[model samples]
Target: MTSPFLSLPGAVGSPVAQHYGAPVAEQRALDAGDAAVDLSHRGIITVAGPDRLSWLNSMTSQQLLGLAPGVSTETLLLDPNGRIEHAIRVVDDGERAWLLVDEGSAEPLAAFLNRMRFALRVEVADVSADFAAVLAFAGGTALAALRALGPVVEWADPWAEVTRGGTQYANGEHAGAEWSAVQLVFPTERLGAVARAVAPAGLMALDALEIRAWRPSRVADVDERAIPHEFDWLRSAVHLTKGCYRGQETVAKVHNLGHPPRRLVMLHLDGSEGELPVAGALVFREGEASDPEARPVGRITRAALHHEWGGIAFALLKRSVPADVTLAVRAGAEAADPQAPVEGVIAAAQEMIVPTDAGATRTIPKLKRL
Candidate 1:
């Protein structure tokens, strides 16, 4: 489906705007629930038939059996060793379960689910070409126009706080205490109707808010070795005591008797140069370049210039990195001198997201004799 937003002046990139010229204002408006974000690039999949919920509940991280209609939640598809494979946003509309995912996810996720269908009475279909998703805060100004699409399907984000059968790893007041993100899915053909109804906010605006919310996305944060504990994801996506699922053993073990090898941390970047480190940039301790062979303490997964927070980013760092240390993000090596230190890096401040002591809840008794 072609994005209706492509024609708007100053709009750039695929269906969604990276920015509409004035991104700061757009960010403020979206956060205040006064504007909408174009997420047409995302994918939607539907699981139909009576066994949809239970079948999914059997394989993923969430407890989805008997999931009530209109309720929003997320789940994780993990590898056998507990590494995250996919993170899916879930909502059921009485007739079928809708799985909303990032753009590259639908095909593989559908194929995987199909392969696991076995004797289940469920059928999965990738309907991304038939529909699109738009983001708004609950009760936002854009709703009246969007609702005109005739009972558009909506998925309320459960990230404002922990949902049932979940856990919170970050302590104290959450920055996202007021977050009320909602996704409205409508027919792709109605794109023009939406374009006429409300103004568009780019992905950057949406991303800044997500960073402030400390939301962990599959497309942005997960890596080859990502686990639920690393992003403090057990709070909304993992059901600790639910029936068996893939990666359940590792999830239980990490939470019960071990810590995630890495933890997610926020990097408050220095934007005085109007620069934000691009995603995948390496993060290091201040002046750690003294040892050219030293490994980065972490890698920046997402970065954005916020309307209020200036330059900000989210990184997955070693769990042992001190919480208060000054850090740096190596944007890229300078072209003139690849070995030059201090040429292409930006200093950063470490804002702890996942706590250092993130796991090992069930203590084992120690014996004096060896």
Candidate 2:
């Protein structure tokens, strides 16, 4: 599908195409004071009617009963088994709710909701095409500038908000670290205005910024069959005490009991010498064979080049692998840079930890579902 924002010059095969309906560049610029993207291509599903909030809360991870109008929660859609079906963000306005999910998962998610719907006073529809969304990122003064425009609600995620307007809107969630997910929406007629208002940049830069932001998303890269715990999303998406929903048992059990069999880790790969290991490339620890067919310790979930760190990639590594083991990613002999060898290159692997005080060690036994 062509990206909706492709007309801006220099956008190629970007994921933004799925949401925008055109092939425009949707990523942010690195050096700018702030950056933005046309998020219209993303899936937006609306659920409304009398049972909106109650019905949704029963189905997802976040507690939604008390979610005030104008506020939103980022959540997940889990399968009956608790494996992640999709990662979603929900914005509510008392009367209605908007769910932002991965582009590829949009249609399937809508279908899932439709199948789950029966007599409940809830209605669901895919609004992604009708409403175009853009993301803006700024710290310090930029947030204040955005706030000056309208009523914005900041959520528990610290640097996040939800705002709306005719040709402009602002919602900053997960904006801390280096980047924020900002949603700017307007009529297609005013896309240029929105783009100009938010300094449009090519999608390539946006991908890089996304890499820097450390925002975990479900994309073609990670795909389904990935448990949320593998990405450490339990901290951000799971509601430990929520009523039984799809996959709640697994989500709950995996958290309070034993550790997840696998964990998400960031790796600094030696990529300057060859094509960076592609997604799905097997990552091997020291002493693992170098043949292209060798069993991998893990698979690369996401990887990108860091100007400061050479090549950095997020991998879902087997928890059984010990820390400090040197890892290797595949580099085909034909394309591998002789300098950046397929063999002998050392990769650093470290579990992605949510930083907290290092002093306490607490483990709680599993609790039965509510």
Candidate 3:
């Protein structure tokens, strides 16, 4: 379905945003709570029935059974091997539990939840078609206005602190402590009116804010091999003391006995080349002029030029790589051109997001065997 924002002048539809005319101006307005962004592309799933909370608590890596109304938390569905499957943003209104997910995931997630309902009084539905999500930075007024449009639920992100039963790997101050973005869900029919009610920013503005906060998102930062420990997701998503779930054993072992094989890092890129490296670009450690054995140690997951930070990226690198290492990202196309022999690269300075010794529990002293 076409977004209602397309009716606005200079509206451009991309996979992420429905941006109106001036994106920069829109971004400033959004940051100041003078505008909003249409994020209707994100999916929504509603789980209803008396057993909603218990059923969700038993299936994911969070302590959700005691979640209070309007309280926001996130949970992760992991495979039996502890690899992340889905990262869901959750909120409840006492009677219904809402799961906000990445685009294209609602149907499959709801289907999975339905299959798990065995004699349980639960009903799962993909309600994405009925509701649209609107986000605003510092959006108290926007939220108050959205509440008047009919059943609306606001989800305040809990990224600033370590949630109960979760662990923190990043030391010192977290970059996301000031993150104040909120998600509001309203009737899909009100989408056009909502778009017209306020100035609108593009997804690019949202990306800059998220990256600056060191916030990891499912759609942009995750892959098949991603584990919660790698991205420091346990900060707000995974509960270490939660009862047995699909990936409980692996989660326990990694947190208590071992470190994650890889870690997440932020890269400050050299924008001198006038272009940014695309996702999946190879990241290599700085090499000596005569060194012929240098190999890529990581790959870029998300890259964007921030209004304040210039070119910045989040990448997954080998845990063994030092936090202070200087790196370079290959700028050439993934498939080399036979006609064009130039191979471009961008230099990047690494900023640690996940610490080298992330799993402190592993350092606990053990008893000597006889």
Clashes of each: 0, 21, 0
TM-score of each: 0.95, 0.77, 0.92
Question: Judged by lDDT, which candidate is best?
Answer: 1
Q: Once superposed on the true structure, which residue ranges of model 2 sit more than 4 Å away at CA?
A: 1-4, 14-33, 140-179, 287-289, 332-346, 354-370
Q: What value does the lDDT take at residue 141 in candidate 3?
A: 62
Please, what are the lDDT tens digits per residue for candidate 2 over residues 153-197? Answer: 222231222222101011123322443555544445555455445
**Candidate 3: clashing pairs of residues:** none
* Off by more than 4 A, model 3: 15-18, 139-141, 148-151, 288-293, 333-342, 364-370
What is the number of residue pairs that collide in model 1?
0
Question: How high is the CA lDDT of each candidate model?
Answer: 0.86, 0.58, 0.82
Backbone steric clashes in candidate 3, count: 0
In model 1, the worst 10-residue window by lDDT is 333-342
The TM-score of predicted model 2 comes to 0.77
What are the per-residue Cα lDDT tens digits for candidate 3 across 1-370? 6677767788877644645667556666666676677888999999999999999999899999889999999999999999999989999998899999988788889889989999999989999999978887674466556556654788888898899999889889998887777788888888888877766788776776677789998988899998999999999999998789989888889889898999999899998887777777777787621133455688888777676778888889999989988988777675122233326778899888998888748566689999
Tell me, by TM-score, which candidate is best: 1
